[model samples]
Target: MSQIDVATKSPIRQRTQGLRSRIEAFVRTFEWTWTSAVLFSMALLFFLLISAVVMPSFWMYYAEQKIGWAGPTDLQAFLEKPFGTSITNPLSLEGYKQVRDAIAMGLTTG
Candidate 1:
């Protein structure tokens, strides 16, 4: 139609145009240098965030494996039962074997 009518425009098209105009106006306010700096700072912060979480976790898992129960002291701490301590129900060797298997598969050795 040559004449514009409010009812003639599709609701979806109207909403899309409105949102696109808002975004364009927003982008126009910032220069390329400001945008690049903001983006770089965000990227650096994100990398630091991921490493902060991941590095400690990796080290903990690494320590758990490398400092495994070779000696009785390590074994005692891991089992939470001293060698002299007596208990009615002993821990299963199956769990111990599974841990060994996991260590072989590159999981934590402890």
Candidate 2:
């Protein structure tokens, strides 16, 4: 009696006794359908989050490894194209500036 009285300082704990009997209480009020739905929703949200956030980086890595991987010749060509002899090449005329540029170059657009 003395130990029990010492344990509880608040009147709120004195009323409930913490409802320590979990087995009988859960058996009376458990809803399986609602619990299953909550679990399924959590699983779906986890799947969506992983696919959306984590999968693109994996796809990009695989794509770069598959198609966009550049050879030494390819990179060397890119760097060497801008470093060649001073060939006075004009812009090509498949653009909106084709006529005006042809006129500037003293070339016929026809």
Q: lDDT per prediction?
A: 0.57, 0.49
lDDT of 2 by residue, 64-98 (tens): 45644222223344444533233553322122133
For model 1, the local distance difference test gives: 0.57
Candidate 1 stretches greater than 4 Å from native: 1-32, 69-110
Residues 1-110, candidate 1: write the lDDT tens digits. Answer: 34476678888887798799999999989666888999999999888766666655565455456745222224434465433333652433333433544544452222
Q: TM-score of each candidate?
A: 0.30, 0.30
Q: Which candidate's lDDT is highest? A: 1
RMSD in Å for model 2:
21.3
Between which residue pairs do clashes occur in model 1? none
What is the overall TM-score of model 1 with all chains considered together?
0.30
